[model samples]
Target: MWKADIIESPPGTSYRSVMEEYGYEVGKVIGNGSYGTVYEAYFTKQKVMVAVKIISKKKASDEYLNKFLPREIQVMKVLRHKYLINFYQAIETTTRVYIILELAQGGDILEWIQRYGACSEAQAGKWFSQLTLGIAYLHSKGIVHRDLKLENLLLDKRENVKISDFGFAKMVPSNHSLRSNSPYRQVNCFTHLSQTYCGSFAYACPEILLGLPYNPFLSDTWSMGVILYTLMVAHLPFDDTNLKKLLRETQREVTFPSSITIPQECKNLILHMLRQATKRATILDVVKDPWVIKFQSEQPTHEIRLLEAMCQIPFSATSNRHQSLDYHI
Candidate 1:
């Protein structure tokens, strides 16, 4: 297993110097989170711009530092796809951890919606299809992205979807498999359900809100339903301010805005995904749904094969600064 390497920096050393030593010219801060900040930087050796997530060890909880952080890095390291953010390298110091990632020039989906309002069915279908493909790729590898919010779905310069933020992602045991005869059917093969509750309240599924040990894969689909709904309408399907009301809302059928017209097929797909945990649509189902397929010019078989092939190859750390160390829980 890969472990974070802790390095001791010289007295009074700055993060900038640390990054510079690794051949990265740090630029302005791009985003901020509870435990750290993301910076836009130029990798001199690679001659490409990259995003660096600088996580402060002191600010993060022990749970995150020990459990989630390691898991996130492990998951990201193995993932490689057109629709997913690529993980480049990781550097750990006494006070901080630096994660180097692909820079998506276009901002997140939430920011796009905030500025441009709701998208048309055609546009929504395209983005949703891309998102579904990314989720399918993750599911194929037995990795579940528990947090599938709009903010986590970023875009490249071409405006294609790139799934980001694997902080809440976890890999399921390899004993489970989707039925070969009916791959699109809702998956119930996993007997070992996930109990940990994570992700934003608005994007969370009913099972998660009810504090049930739920199938993490299905929970991801439910969040995708919320994202699809948000893309059609300019806002969230359920108001998250009141937990009671939010739970009640999620338990029932998702309602659409009468003011904006949505295709019947699209509505049907959303309904299938947003329903009860046992009946929710799997990632494969979403990919095969007619509404989602309408947006694709060609079949996704090639892309699916590509993702599967990529997963077979072992990931190697490219940076000399990244040295493996022993990890213990």
Candidate 2:
């Protein structure tokens, strides 16, 4: 219902032309991001449900496509993890590039977080493990997902997490594992202390903040650590007015408060993940940890139940900080 002039969203070729040429039945808007908008649309001839991501025509130059879209397609083509959203097709329009993909009914993890305070310990473990496996698979294929924030992760009808968005993702050559010449090298989100940091500023590793070159493999591990912290604690471990202060706090080893009684193994895992790049554990090792196994033995059905209950609760409600939450960051 929220329709806009196609030329306005992207310029030059009118959106009216594409609608007439492609025969697209515009439906309701489903999501929005910094670059574009996603809508649920139906192809008239094919009669199939698809998610159409329309990027601005002003920025859809061939140079931009060469720099970002192709890399995204290549990485996505190689990825087949269960927790990753699947790409169906890609179409080019006069004023926009339409990326046709699988549609997630449950929206994103950010919506769930805003509605519910946070997930239970057991629930966090399941999603945490799933994300680790998916990221490990991407690394195995030489693909690095630079942005791994809550807003970028979507969920399917089964309530399983699906990693989405590859605008910030980059592919490392088969022989190369790290970057030494990136301008953002000083930024923690670009390089970890002995590793390459390609994730969000909020979830960057300490080694990354220190401007140390880091292993590409461990970059995702650090982001996963930050995500786990947020899922359990309901807030980021480090927040600041700018990236510098954020980096400083992360480098100084900021963490959750002591009031929360997390399992020692979970606590250890979080600590291990937040350590300097040289000391951090591998994703395989973390996934294979005894604590992780014990946590996995629990039922996801129950976790989903808890998730559903929490999703119904308003974020304005007080949290169980004394027993389950860590107030200090």
Candidate 3:
């Protein structure tokens, strides 16, 4: 039997507190993130399982505990999307904060990839299209998810991808598209998204590494490119232990190994996304791309056999270059 963690609840405070007051039943720890521990909990009235992420106020800086966390909560409450994980409820006590999220029982894409090398193009196409759609939702709402990585992409039982974790997300303020919006203008994750960059090093854009103000919208596109490359090749396109060298490599041309055979249309899209050009492929380019649209119109297939098939093979040359993935400047 699993014992639930006890948390004191004050009357009429928030959704979480009210739930806690009613003897909220919690299950075993299910996941972990940079800021908190996630657990499975039951909503007695609703009788549905949910993932509860608890963040301790003690570990965070005063500024973050008071300012940033509140902002994140506010933005998340208003911003809802199909492909993004649903934020159900939040409650802040004197010592800690509890966040209720949809449970992705299928686990995260990182675990999926580690166990299974890569998904077949069909699976990849479905997942990739969904990913871009979710991201597009964030951008449309003037929110920039700064920390986008395979680890943050959660999967439900249906193999559908959910973009989670807005801990480091910025809110921009604009109805204009990212392409038309002036990057030089003040950006918020909800409003204008920042010129200052802070995200996981491995997935960060070059402008972030260069120590210059960056375009938060474009930053996401770069990470998407890295993700697209990984989906097609089962490995990172550019990786170097030396951050300096890695940045340089990313600024240059990207190449594929001779081992894998990817169609030119897919390759062209990947290359277009990975380019360091002033004008890179936008969300429209990605969605309207011949390959993506094809998958969208086709019958749904949740076949992610890429990992299961390669489980027996000993794939080499993979490293977690993100060991020091802390935010840069």
Candidate 4:
């Protein structure tokens, strides 16, 4: 329903008048990004505050408006899990586009991690489980969240992790193989679906950094590892003052702080998740991990049990490189 009537008709309506008509009161600007500015607004009827993302149509390219933005809205509309951001509406005017989204009162994970330096394993464990479920849900839907950084992981008032920002998400059907008949079929999966590599450097996977096409699922899992490490230790697992050095380091093993008191299981989980593309953990592997299970507060529900069983099939990491890479939106 939201997708069918995304673009508002009778363009050029003042934003204030539009809000009043919808029984909403616009408030302060809370965030900004390349696509738009996000404002905090009150829904008078619902008595809830929502994030209103406003995108300027004129400043965007044809492909961005017709392809990227529309695709983003479509993805958000389809995903309805608790760990993911909830979408209410998409309104496009002649001058701009407005996306009504859930507002996370706890703010982004980045700020919280920065403030606390490092969270206890008990605390991090809860967040990790939620984060993993969110990513797993995306993968199950055949959607590859190309970008997953601390900033994209938002927290609600209760500190529940809600994975957000689908600007680079690409859908690849699980059973629909692109290379079924090609000689290099298994060599590449996301080659045709997504041509460019994009993500924050610190958390990006080896395959993406090496200028090669990647399996979006595994790459997302790798980012989860980086996220876990950061949450446990307060800093990036592979941080460096030099970009070249950092890139070189990601190819090798990750280093942990000696002074920190990390559990053996936590360390092992990070090791497996942050391994080379060929040896890294799959989504199911993360869920089935003994450490993850040990730290998790309770048994997963029937749905999670089904996912764990369903994803138990074997999966290896994608091929990677050390060459310079190129990227696009």
| Candidates, ranked, lDDT | 1, 4, 3, 2
Model 3 C-alpha lDDT per residue in residues 214-317, reported as the tens digit of each score: 55766788888888888878887877568988887877778988888887888888888876534556554565578887777442222112111211122221
lDDT of 2 by residue, 42-64 (tens): 76767766677877756566655
lDDT score, candidate 4 = 0.75
Instruction: Give the top-scoring candidate (TM-score).
Output: 1
What candidate 4 gets wrong by more than 4 Å, as runs, is 1-7, 174-193, 297-329
Which 10 consecutive positions of candidate 2 have the poorest summed lDDT? 183-192
Q: What is the C-alpha lDDT of each candidate?
A: 0.81, 0.63, 0.69, 0.75
Model 1 alpha-carbon miss at residue 111, Å: 0.7
Q: Which residue pairs collide in model 4, if any?
A: none
lDDT of 4 by residue, 37-83 (tens): 98899988889889888888877788889888888888888888888
Better of 1 and 2 by TM-score: 1
After superposition, which runs of candidate 2 have C-alpha atoms over 4 Å from their true positions?
1-24, 43-48, 60-63, 176-198, 207-212, 295-329
- Kindly give the stretch of ten consecutive residues in candidate 4 with the minimal lDDT sum: 317-326
> Deviation in angstroms for 81 in model 3?
2.1
Candidate 4: residue 136 lDDT (0-100) = 66
Q: Of models 3 and 4, which has the larger lDDT?
A: 4
The TM-score, computed over Cα atoms with residue i paired to residue i, of candidate 2 is 0.73
